[model samples]
Target: MTTGRLLIVMNAGAGHSQAEASRAAIRAVLDAHGRAYQFFLADSGSALPQQAALAVQQALAEGGAVIAAGGDGTLNTVAQAVLPHSLPFGVLPLGTFNYFARAHGMPEDIKAATEALLSARIQPVQVGLLNERIFLVNASLGLYPTLLEDREAYKAQYGRSRLVALWAGLVTLWRARGRLRIVLEHDGQRSKLRTSMLFVGNNALQLAQLGLPSAQQVEQGALAALALRRTGLFTVLLLLLRGAIGQLHTADKVLHFTFQRISVRPRLPYGRRRIKVATDGEVGWMSSPLVFAVAPQPLLLLCPATMETPA
Candidate 1:
C-alpha cells in the first residue's frame, strides 16, 4: 500500500480455471479499490522466471509491490526475484494446494485474494533455499520430483484435481525405484542414510497437515527433513497413506529431523554429478552437495492483518 503502483506478474500456465476470468476478477478488485497496477504476463514456460524478475526490477525501481497471480510455482519465481531486492511481494493463489497462501491466511478465491491485497501490510516471512534458489514452500529430492513430473503429466492429460494428483502419486510410488545414499551434515553432526526420498518442509501448513513432528519447528523458522527409510512399493504406498491421513509422525520407517541448515551429498552413479530436485512443484537439477538452508533474510510478503509472523 505504498504510493507507488503494483506490478502483477501472472503466469500463463495457470490453467486452474479460465485465465481471463481470474484476470477480470483481479482487475475488478483493483479497480474498485482505485489501485494503480500493471500486469506482466508470462506467455510461455521458459520465460516465466525472467518475466517475474523483470517485474521485480520495475517494482524495485518504481517503489511498488510485485504480485504473483498464479500458483505456488509462480509465487516462488516472484519470491526469488523479490528476495534479492527486499521488495514487497504478494500472492493470489490459483494452485491446487495453495499451501503458502492458505498457511498465511490468504484466500485462494481470486477476487477475495486481490481484495485482501488492497488492505494488506508487509511482513517478513520465512524463506528456504536450495543453494541460491529460493523455495517458498517445500523442496524435495528423488521420488517427489518424479512424482511431480507425473502429476503434471496427469494434470495435463486429465485435470488438475486432488484426485488426479493422488492418482499420479500412487502410480509414481508403485513405479518408484532406487535409493539415494546421501551423507547429511547439519549442526556439526553427520549421518549416512540410504533412502528413496529426502523431503524438506518449509511450510508449516503442509507439514502440520502431514502430521509431521517438525511442523512447529518449521513454523518457528527451522526446516524439517523427512526421509523414507524403505522404498519397496508396498511400504511406500503404506507410508503415503500414513502421510495422507496425518500419521507420518507415527511411522517407524520415516526419519524426521529439524535443521536450520543441512548439506546433502548424494552418492550418484558414474559420471552423474547432478540430480533432479523439486521446489514448490517445479522440478529442476542441482549439482552435487545440495545444501538446504533457511535463507539469511526473510521475504517481505504482503499479508492481511489476520496473518501472524514470528518476531
Candidate 2:
C-alpha cells in the first residue's frame, strides 16, 4: 500500500449538506488514524466518468488509494475508471441507498464508514457488466428503466424523498403501457418473452430479500436475473405490493435465473441503433443486442476485516 494520501473523488451536487458533514467526519477519522488524503470534487460542468477516470489515473500514478464518495451512481462512475487498472476501490457510502457499500459491510454512518476505510482489507468483489459499462448493483430495461427515468424527473421537480419516489413509481405504473418483446439467449438456448420489467442483481443478499434464490456469499462470481411476465397496471401494482412484503420471488409471474452471462435483443428488427438502459440507479443509452456479463476477475475492495457476509 502507498504511504501517500488517499484520493477521494466526490460528486459535488449530491446530498450537499450531508456530503459536507461527511467530509468533516472523514477528516476527523483519518486524522485520528494518522492518515493523509486529498479530495477531487466533480463539478456540474465536468463530465463525471471522464473526470473520475482522470482522477483514478492520477491517483494510481501517485501510488495512492482512490475512494468514491456519493451514491451508487457516483460509485458506478468511479468503478468504470478503476476496473481497467484493477486498483483498490474504497467507498464512503454518502449515497441515498448505498447498496454497494452496505452490501459489502460498510456502515452508513460517516465516521464508521471512514474507519472501515482506514482499517480496510483488500477483498475481491464481483461486478456486473451491462454492455461495455460496469454496474455494481443491478441493471434493467423496458418498464423498469422508464420508471427510473420518471423517478429522476419527479425528484428533480418535486425534491427527492422516499415517499416522493414511491409516488413517482405509482404515477408511472398508472400510465405505463407496452411490453418489450425480446429474446433472451443464455447457455446455448434462446427464449422469447414479453415483459414489463427485468432486473439483474450482482448482490445475492439483495436477491434473497426479494424472495429469490441466493447464496450466502454474493461474491460467488455470478449474476441473478429476474423477469416479470405481466404488463398490466394492476398486476404491476400487485407485484410491487408483493415486493414490498417480500414475496416477489414466489409470485407466479416472476422468473429467476443465475448465469455467468446473458444477451438480450429485440425480437423485431429496428432501424434505431441504441436503447435507453438503467444500471445501479443511473440511466443511459446502449446499442442493441446488449450483452450482460460478469467479469472473470473481482474488484479489490477495501472492506473491514471483521465484517462478515451480508445479512
Best by TM-score: 1
lDDT of 2 by residue, 196-232 (tens): 7778889765676676765343556778888889658
Least accurate 10 contiguous residues by lDDT in model 2: 211-220
Clashes of 1: 0
Candidate 1 lDDT over residue span 117-183, tens digit each: 8888888989999988989899999889999999999999998899999999888877777788999
Worst 10 residues of 1 by lDDT: 11-20
The estimated TM-scores of all candidates read 0.97, 0.93
How far is each candidate from the true structure, as Cα RMSD in Å? 1.3, 2.2
- Model 2 regions lying over 4 Å from their true place: 1-4, 215-219, 308-311
